[model samples]
Every structure is written in structure tokens, then in C-alpha cells.
Target: MTNEKRLPPLLKLALELGPLALFFVANAYADRFGFAEGQRIFFATALFIGATLVALAVSYALLRKLPIMPLVSGVVVVVFGGLTLFLQDETFIKLKPTIVNTMFGAILLGGLYFRKPLLEIVLDSVFDLTEEGWRKLTLRWALFFFTLAALNEIVWRTQSTDFWVSFKVFGIMPLTIAFALAQTPLLLRHEAKKAEEA
Candidate 1:
């Protein structure tokens, strides 16, 4: 609520998604670029790392500050991605989502344990809600994050590299969007009235 203008939703989505899209594309065509069968993921990880940094830079350039969630995610991407490239291990990159989601889940739940709703801060305080509403919403998001972390673990452990990449791009994004849209009713129901305007 600092009166700073947020990025347009579509633009924000693009910035958030552009790296993933590029990662997918890079992985899909790594063979055409002559990377070995086992090296495709590594190649894609390099691109993903670069794209994430670029996206963060763009966000900072536009807003003069980075969003908390993306900045945290980007840091993990770079770290895990670097490990993947330097060590020639796909496990690090594959585990990145699981680690990130679990961290977010724990953070949210920990906040609630202390009677704080950290989601509001993470979301830049965009939504004004009653305390109960905030608690409920934060709890829902925490569980959702845990679910995503579990899903990522299952997929990455059991699926092929290509399949895991596809799921990360296709599966997770749609699920998140659906979940968010499904919260509209809760948000509307709990919206705080501007008593000061009376």
C-alpha cells in the first residue's frame, strides 16, 4: 500500500511465465541444437537460469523493486540451476520446485502459528480482508503450496525428464490459476468496508 503502481496483470503474468516458457522451449529443442540425450536438461537449465535473471531484472527495471515471491523463486532457480549445470546433475533442478513450494508452505503456516497472515505481505497487501478472512485464505494457500510440493516430488521422482518439464509448465500453471479464481467468492465475501470513507 505504498501507492506504487503494480504491473498490469497480463504483463506481470508474462514476466512470471516467460522464463518457464523459455525453459520448456529450450528443453524441447535441445536435441536439434545437438546436445546429447543426457545433456538436454542441463542445456535447458542454463537457459532457465538466464531467463529467470532477465525476468527479475525487467521487473526491477519497471517497478524499481522486485516482487517477493518471484525474487525468492528466482534465487532458487539460479542456485539449483547452477548446481545442475556445474555438477551435471538433473536432480537439483528437478527438486527446485519441491523445495520452493515447501518453503513457502512452511513460511505461511509458521506465520499463522504466530497469529500473523504473511500472505498479505507476500501479495503486497493488495487485498483488504477481515482478520478471519486473511487467516482462512492464508491457510488455503499454505495447503495448496504443500500439495504442489508433493506433486512435484511425485512427478520428478517417477516421471521422465521431458514429462516432468511438461507437467511443471502445463499442469502447475493451470492448477494455480484455477485455484486462484476459485477464491473470488471468498475474497468478495470478506472484503473490508472502507469505514473511513463514511
Candidate 2:
């Protein structure tokens, strides 16, 4: 049970991004299968949920159960996914990520009220940080998600549907990757304890 090498952070990010990419790609092609924009969005979301299930299956096969953060995302996906199907509207599906991210941000930030860094519960398996380090990191992430939600609302509301779709695939995805990449230096700077623990 001793593999000295650790999985890189980018691999974890890929696990999360893979399903989103699948969603975008499927949405781009759904019309060929007779789906209109709304139906395309619904199917795209369903496809994302399906991808999440597949990821969960693979995660369980490799690590058992689900990763904490992804588990929360999966739950929201199912909840919103149900609404998308029942109501037969794609907007609900489009808003799913925003809802999940907003909730996550609020919950993480709210934990500070109790002087706890609850984010550590989800992230501890991947990274180690001192208590203060965790608190600051958590705060930043909370704000980041909140801002992302706001941005999502603005883009999807004001832009043309084609523009919004392009934003999802090009704008948001790139921004997220850039943001994640920017975090690596911070992670490395805080890697002292994690390195020891590892």
C-alpha cells in the first residue's frame, strides 16, 4: 500500500473537468440527433449527469465511495437534472452549476462563523495546510465561486444563446483552468506540512 508518488492536482482537476467537456461537446452535437436548443441543453445536462455517474463508478472502483467535493456536485446535478427533465426546460439545467457553486461557497464561508475550516474535510485528502492557511484559502475560494455565479448569471442573461454557449466552452473553461493553475504556487508554498505528512 505504498506508492510514494502522489497524483498531481491537475489530474484531480481533469476528473472534474472531463464531464463538463463531455457536456459541451454533446451539446454542440445534439441538434444532429433532432434536439433543439432547449432539448439540447437538457440532453447536455443529462449527459453530464451520466458522465458524473460514470466518474463515480470509476472513483469507487479505484478509491471506493465518492470524493467529497464531487459527491456534493453530483447531488446538485441530480437534483437540478430532475427539474430539467420534469419541467422540460433547459434553463434549469444551465443554472445547475451556478446553484451548486453558490451553495458550496456559502457553506464554506459560513463555516468561518464557527471558527472551522470545513473545506478541509473535502480537501485534506489532496492538500495539507495549517489552520490559518486553510481558512484564508477557503475564504478565497468561497468568494471565487460567488463571483463565478454572478458572472454566469450575467453572461447567460445578456448574451445571445450562441454567445453563451461559446462562453461556457471557451471563456469559462479557460478562466477556470487559469485560476486553478494560479493556485499551484500557493499550494507549493504551503506544501511543507503536506510533504512531511505524505
Candidate 3:
């Protein structure tokens, strides 16, 4: 028998996304726990932080190492989570995504300024592409993440909490699917070339 133990990439992605799902659920159900408004926010933040840590552990077990992007994301979760709990404010927790996405966008776009494509480094295991291809792919992801940040601000500012929760689950996920689908031609082109070379 073989010694293979690692999980597939897509499964790993699902596991990684699981914590965010849990965070949203915990926040939505906050009142049921009979927590005070400040307590509920703190409790939810604690749960979110715990969920992220657990997700990170599971991901590491499955993949043999922490995925860098998710690790960074988890760090933000914990940091913002701590701040939210300390300040007893929901605003800090809510702003976490904006800070994260904006930071990612800045780093990505800035890498392009230095004539480097940082996405290739992070996604190297999942996809193989040349420098130019990596550059384009990186730029696309940078823009997409920044767009998500803007949309988060818009939704949180204008909508009810319930609506934002629904959008966080239903809206952003579908957008991700559609965006990934749009990249199919790019993946296929590289996949075909790899096939030919093999």
C-alpha cells in the first residue's frame, strides 16, 4: 500500500472556508445564547477566533503545512478578534475583512510595481505558469479581493445584519465560483501545454 495521506486541494479549501462559515453562524445566533450585547459580541469573536485556529490545525493535518494565505487570514482573525473582545465592539470584527482584503490587494499590486508576481509563490502548488501568466493571474486576484472589500463596506454600511450575513454566505461564494469559472480558459491552456510536454 502507498503512504499517501494528504487531502486534495479542493477539500483543503473547503476546510479552510469552514471557520468563516462558523463565525457567521455564531454571530447570527448570538442572541440565543442569552449573552449581553457586549458579551455576545465578545463571545462571538471568541468563537470565531477558536474556529479559525481549529480550521488552521485541521488544514495543517490534511496538507502537512499551513497554507500561507489562510494562515495570514487566521492571524488577522485572531488579532481583530482580540481587539473586538477588548473593546466590546462589533465594528472591529466587521472591519477585519476590509483590512485583510485591502492589505492583500496592496501587497499584490505593490509586488507588480517591483516586477514580481507574488501570486505564483502562494499558488505554486496548485498551478504552474510562467512569469507573465503569473503576473496577469496575480493582478486579477488582487482586483477581485479589493472588489470584495469594497462590497463588504457597502453591504455592512447599508444593509441589515441579517442581510449582510446572507450576502456573506450566498453572495460572496457565488461570486468566487463565477470568477473561478471565468479563469477556466487560463487553467485549460496551461493544463494542455503540460499534457503536451508530458
Candidate 4:
């Protein structure tokens, strides 16, 4: 196996966020670039698929392995994006976020049902926590993912395509970041408690 340096946090964030940024940009300017209304969604979906593949390739190059969440998400993007293009239906792409988020939420909650706090698997490298802390954090994240799924459904059903794209790009990201930051205190407390016990 080849040894590879772990990606820096900023570079990791860029790899994850860059594809969504490209999708949003492509959609926003599709019309000015002379794509018809019907063609804009297809154009954006194609761009999104390409960007997601590039992101995955970059992640593997840096980390020497694909991250689970992004691998799952990239698969969904490519499949749904391809359906959107093949069927010429924008709804497939619109529904992708809802499906992906719901799947994640279900998996997390299901892990709890099986007496496993699976968030630890994803986050253990970055955090030290008691079992109770892991359980609480996992529950919080599961609920958050469900909330995001519901929000995506509501936005796509009620809002314009452009509005939904903006919400996906701007709203969901900030909310996730804020939620993660808000958990810092709890994480620190758990770490301290673990240290004390040690």
C-alpha cells in the first residue's frame, strides 16, 4: 500500500464543498450561456456529476482511500444525475438530497437500535468521548440528518429550482457547521470526563 498524507482540513472541506459550488454556479448561469430552460437542469446535473467524480478522485489521491460518506453521496449524485439526464426529468436530481440525507439518518438511528453508536466509527479519529457521549452525539446527528432531509423535501416541493439550489449550497452547509460548533462544549466536557477517569 502506498503511504499518503492525510488531507488538511481546509483542503478536505474544499473537496467536499467544491462540487456543490460548481453545480450552483452552473445552474445560475445556464440561461445566460444560452441553455434553454429545459436544458439548464440537465446541464447542471452533468456538471454536478463531473465535479463529484473529480472530488472523489482528489480525496483518494490525498487520503489513499475514499471517505465513506462522500463515496455514498457521490454514488447517489451520479445515479440520480444520470437519471435526470436520461429521463430528462429534473425531479430525480431534486430528490437526491432527500434520499441521501434520509438514508444517513436511518443508518445512524438503526445503528443505535443495534446497540452500536456508529458515529464513533466516523468520528473517532477526531474525537475522544465516553460511550454515553458517543450515544448522545450520534442521536443528535441522526436527528439533524432527518431534519435536513425534511428541509430538502420542503424546499424542493415549495420553492423554485434556483431557490432550492441556493438553500442546498448556502443554508444546509452553514446549519451543519453551526450545529457542529455548538457540539464543541459537549465534546470538551466528555473529553475532560474521560481524562479524569483515566
Ranking by TM-score: 1, 4, 3, 2
Measured with C-alpha atoms, the lDDT of residue 6 in candidate 4 is 66
Instruction: Estimate the TM-score of every prediction.
Output: 0.95, 0.82, 0.85, 0.94
CA lDDT, every model vs. true structure? 0.92, 0.77, 0.79, 0.90
Tell me the lDDT of model 4 at 80: 95
Which pairs of residues clash in candidate 2, taking residues 3 or more apart in a chain or in different chains? Answer: none
Score candidate 2 by lDDT.
0.77
Residue range 1-198, candidate 2, lDDT tens digits: 233333456765667778888888888899998997757777777888888887767666666567667888888877787788888866776687688779889998899778888877767756777777778778878888898888888988787656666787788879877886877777776664775677
Error of 1 at 90 (Å): 0.2
Model 4 poorest 10 in a row by lDDT: 1-10
What would the per-residue lDDT of candidate 3 be over residues 133-188, giving only the tens digit for each residue? 77788899899989999999998889866677678778988997899789877766
Q: In angstroms, give how far residue 185 of model 1 lies from its true place.
A: 1.4
Q: Candidate 3 at residue 21, lDDT?
A: 79
Worst 10 residues of 3 by lDDT: 1-10
